[model samples]
Target: MKKLTKFKRIVTRIIVLTLVLSCAGGVMPSTFTPNAAELYSDKEKYISYNEETEMYEYSFYDAYVYDIDATPGQIMLDIIPSTGSNYYNYYYHKKILITWHSYNGENAAQYDYENQKLAESIQPESRINIKFAAKNKYDDLSYKDGYLGWESHKDFYVSQIISIRNSDEHIYGDINDDGIIDSFDVVTYQKYITDNLQYKLDETQFLNADIDLDTEITNEDCRQVIDFTLGSSKGFNGATNIGSIRIDNTVSQAMSLGVKNDIDFATAEIKFGVDVLKKCYDPEKNNTENILISPLSISSALAMTANGADGDTYEEMEKTLGNGLTLEQINEYMAYFISHLPDKDKEKVYLADSVWFKNDPTLKIYYEFLEKNRKFYNAEIYKSQFDETIIKDVNNWVNKNTKGKIPRLIDSFNIRSNTAMMLLNTLYFESEWQEPYIDTIDGTFTDLNGQKHLIKEMHSEEYQYFDLGNADAFKKPYLNGDYSFVGILPHEDVTFNEYVANLDGKELADGLREYADPETIRLCVMIPKFKYNYQKSLKDILTKIGMEKAFDPDNADFSNINDLSVEGALPLYIDDVLHKTKIEVTEKGTKASAATAVIMGMGAAPPEEKKTIVINLDRPFIYMIVDKNNVPLFIGAATQLSEN
Candidate 1:
């Protein structure tokens, strides 16, 4: 019995030594055999020892444990070296190299400068165990803990057993590591998935290409990369929390104030729209012409210009634009309205603002004015030579913002020598109908002048109908029910001019506020397909609406825009207010673009239906595009249907 005990003890010692050597990363002897008790009993199991490779294979872990033949000095250098070509310095301080050595179950000690020297002195043939941990300084690096070796370390002798991989964290879709997520990354990712690149991605690039992080690169991953390149609000990982607009805490706090006062601003805007429409429309002279205007566009441009007005000039603009609301309230509300506007695939509304001033030493624009516009309206400010080139630049900007609808906003004739600065605003809208027209028929549209012309009329059944005593109205919704197109046809006895002339802002606002239940009201609606362009100079209209002093060259005070205290300084005043608009109404949807320029010299829906009503717009009528809040975006009088 004593002899048997000694033999078992010897076998146990051998097994323990083998385990220690394997764990320490030392080569296992081929002649050695593991005890039956220590070896896996089921040889068919996925996890088992391979005698040929002298390693343990774990199919479930998807990893392998192998012995590495290297000295303590070489292993240490592989992890973190004292000098040249060290893994620690290769990351260029972007990553913190953490390393330690363990033997006989000793606790880990930081592999600092002193330990590095001690490790370097060890002989090459001596076996040593080393492990590495790396922390990213920027917290942007992606890390995986395993035995997978980086391509850069493939040639190293320690790579077979090393667990350290040094890869810089890359922008999610920037596969090429060029520090930009763009179209090139999309192309490279496509080539990689199709094996068309004639090369394979490195470890880092391969990880980045997996934008969805699904461990498999498919067409979906490629599509996500494309979406990110195309300015999607979502990130590469398809996280929807990302926002296109960065609203700082200050802006966020102000947004609450704006929301509280939205109704007051809406009332003022409606009043302003009605007043501008009445002044611009001449029933006798423009009886045969259609008139369209974007109240939102004009108000935005004037609001931006209002920032540069001081004294009485500012008061008049504040009263006219805001109906008594202070500039602070106006700025905050405008910001709130813009940021809350819906922008999606089917429905898109974009508003862009820009300010340009003559580049002359004599004229000095206040930084505060420019900053205020930037903070509130996000207006782009520029200093130009006021030459022909500026005209092209301004026109190109307008064209781009308007989606090429209004190709030119200014000409050489508009930019005079005395023009100190110009404030411009552009609004673009494109949306599909909630219920598209199914059929079209030939019809005749009679102008107010009694002239008749053939027109194509889109026919659809609408559920929401309104009776305003003086006119019959219908509201057709756009996609998502966020906005609608409203039409009002006056009674046959009431002339179109008389109906408009008597329209009051409060009455119009109150009339629109009345919502029709789809279950109770229904209508067979017919609207003519029309496309036209309209332009007007608002110098006279604004003067008639209580801004006469703004146009006076001597009385105008735009001291906020420029320093009037300097000697021989050209006093700034409102030079001209130009408004241009274009609209196209088709069976599918509506496309409208408007631009308003305050050229300053120095200073600046619903559902259900039971009842039905037939409403045909074969004569002159009034139309408007309004939001869910009943706030008007555009209002027009379609007196004629001729294409412009």
Candidate 2:
């Protein structure tokens, strides 16, 4: 069994070497033929006499090629016995001679049976051919003479054409050469740096392990690998754009849930966003009012709060945010999504979460809830006195997380004495257009109330066009193509609010999935440069969306958040859900930020042939900043335009 296994290993090694050589450039054909005399009767044979050649021929055994490294320019070759005997028994009175020659037949180096291995210096881009031979000490003479001197045998040659190049030219952090920089590479690199690697890394892998290109393996390289694995904004030398390949239990669970649903989690996310939009936008009362909301922000904040709820409150929050998925599933999905989000220095989508509870001794916050949030959401937890100072701290955290887009989230009046805790989620997105609009033309935007306002419209030609039946839409990609700005202009017959009201999540999701081929269809997009800030208290909105139990102080079940066993402890209910957003759409790109605070009280398609589609947003239209997965990060409407 052992011999069979060894044979299989040798065969695998030869196949792998053949493949490597083939990939490098080419491989020389095998010219080895077994001698019949040696194979038939090799009891104590030293050499074989060839009848055709009329001379003594050397008996050769099989040789296996292990690996090749370019930096040191060495090839690992293992010569084993053909009869599966020990080396000592097979070559007892014999000495093996290995020689390497350059491509031009120039002798490079020679070795004489030193541990059956050889290492020689071969320059890069040079081809080396190796030859192996064995000579045995003569105890008897042949028919030629009675001499007892050692005689040279016929050489056994296995030629390989190796063209090695500098290792620094390969992927920087892809140490395993799996075509991705992932956690496995991080582990392998860490093992290499620590000198605990079981197998030696080749030249290419060694260079890849040096992530910073400092020519030395250090902890910093391991740190960069870890950072890249964890999805850092500052990537590991340009190699960080390969996307994350880490798959933990949370990611697995999320993926399983998505697969079970027969649709992506992004569809459910978009459904929740569209639901919020429909509830927030009042077509009759606020027809001319601009509305903006980040469903991601709202959902994240509510998800954190859901971790602290028990029964009806948890169910309502889960339904509103997760679209019928459980809290655990939602948490896993959101966690995986946020961690794997593609982020660049210039074009970034930063999402941050925090939970602050009043530091009063009477109100004891649940440790399990906070730990779950920290583990899944990476949320920052704080215990504060809930005073004017705590208000500033919360606002400061919001301001920093939003990249100053939202300077203040909560004032003194917003943080009441009944507020026991606050769960906040902030999203900051800044990205330049994939194709910047270089021209700006004076245009007029007619509001829903038929009020015309002079505006400066940014004009650009987009390729991705979407026909929403009642709405003409166009998608303009941001830099890196990880996110895009989708503009949906309702048809003249249908009002903006009417279009939004009639639009369902499935329709929008399916419509976004279908778009005309850019090569065939061209979109002439003219969008008004708009800047706006929107703030609203979502207590009534959420209640209208079937979250009434969460706001009901008497009926809300938030026992998981605080210790209700304490005497005279008022039940914690969601006092209000505050949402604030700011957006600036210019010729360069869009810079949008949003903050959602769940104030906790003692409560909680292919187009056919060259067609041009013109989508002019000369009136109220819906705009959304969506991720690569078509999940809406920020969805809003531009009903009215102003200079500010």
Candidate 3:
């Protein structure tokens, strides 16, 4: 009897030991009670890749426990992988690092709402299960291992099979992840920085919250968010400020008729540029002692304004602006043009457009017009009281957009009482020459009036695009090959004004098409270093070019600008077409800024030898800053040189 009793005791002891071993192996019985203290580990584990399965494996060292009676809550996690891991390079993958927070029976609605907001915020990386479960609920709402369907359930294992890689794509100020950076994002970012955010974020959200990408959250990120949201600055991302604005400027996806081809559009731009230069060069019209005008800025501003015109006004404006292409075609061309403009290290080009209207209750703006401008032009629309402060506001915007090149655009009284709206475009460019000038040497430059001015000449001998057909033209590219400065030195016997008057768009286009090939052509170039600023009211220029009806208040039909049926609505016509431009050319390269405002009032190095072409700009000559597409950015005649 004693031996049998001892054997029974040993069997019981073995059964108890088996249960303990099973618990130690990560298999807890359903009835086992969990200790909250032992559920969490102090050290976090990173995800590791398994070569055998070719999958990323994440092993939970400890189970995070949320008691049945505990309040529903969230915990922001940072599960950064080890350094030099292959996963860090997967930037394009849509990924989210998700850990279940909690869902209580009493607050199921709250759980659904908060989780829904979180799911919406995950973008460019994660996607919510759009598939429906047995009921109307989304498959992802409920707990499911490996497959996050939106149905609700009661299991507390934090179940979901997420195959998402870590999200590495983060817009500079896109903290909320709604595909845009705006005031709401600024608020959320500020809260996160200040430690006042109500709920915690997941690992991906934390990654994106690092706005400056310094790997640490700070106050500067919040300030950057505010600056971008308020339009006080271009954007937080250093890649391209224009792209950041594009994120917010998302209107309709309908593609407009773009230019028929790059060459055709470039030819048209060349023609229009020549026309503008001719009109601006007329002795009776131009008042600037030294001239520099941005054909791109003027053309873009006019194109945007033409969208709001109709009848004779529209027809004349369209004829003047569009070189035979329809408005749809022009819209397509401008959209393509702006998108292709280069903005990067050492060579930066920023072009911004905006429309500001008086906050008059009687006016109603057309949605289609606004949408088209927003989508194509990426123009900012603002409605403000046309008070004395409007001038400061507009100038502030100009200063910010141009990086303070043209600080004060207008005085306090630039906006007349009859002015109903104002449209503006600002262009900023800075680039380093691929082959910088050797050095500044004192030289003599003869002005158009036969006046000889002592100037510093920049000399360099290198392989450049050179042709002596219509005129002696040599192209000097900037740091990148995206843009070039083409200087045309007319024949020694020909006068600057005479050559310009005779040079038409086709001739210039033909010469450029032939010479500006990617192949290197040997050339010796010598040009004077010049700095000049030009400002003018283009009213006469536009009228001279066949857009006269747009300036005439009585004859103009700008009925499309705003709803004409609204009470107190007055006829809207362009008040003034003002243009301000500044450029500096030195041994390094060029830094230029131009602002065009339309106010409406109720109303290098080397290879020489094979075929050497010499270009010496000792006399007056014409020059242009052009892009890869031969689209002229700035066109001017260096008739005079001012001593810096």
What would the per-residue lDDT of candidate 1 be over residues 328-357, giving only the tens digit for each residue? 888887887777777886699999887887
Give a tens-digit lDDT track for model 3, residues 501-538. 78787678778876544344557788788777788888
**Deviation in angstroms for 378 in model 1?**
0.7
lDDT at 313 for candidate 3?
85
Lowest-scoring 10 consecutive residues by lDDT in candidate 3? 127-136
What are the lDDT scores of the predictions, listed in order?
A: 0.66, 0.66, 0.64
TM-score for all predictions?
0.59, 0.58, 0.59
Q: What local lDDT does model 2 show for residue 373?
A: 80
Tens digits of per-residue lDDT for model 2, 1-644: 99996776566445434433442443322322233243345322434444542333333322112223322233333222222211112222222223333111322332222212333443222222222232322223211111122433532322222222222146667787545665456556555655656666654467567654334677777666665555453555431111212112222211222222224567877888888888888876856668899988998898888898877777778877777677888887777766766577558888888787777777877667777787778787777777777766777677777765676677788888788888889998998787765436677988888888988788788878888889988889998888899999988899776788898887888888878888888779888887778888988988988888888877888888787766656678888889999887866678899999999777330007888788889888888999878878999978888543
Measured over all alpha carbons after superposition, the RMSD of each candidate to the real structure, in angstroms, is 24.4, 23.8, 22.0
**Candidate 1: residue 222 lDDT (0-100):** 69
- Model 1's alpha-carbon lDDT is 0.66
Deviation from native of the Cα of residue 223 in model 1, angstroms: 40
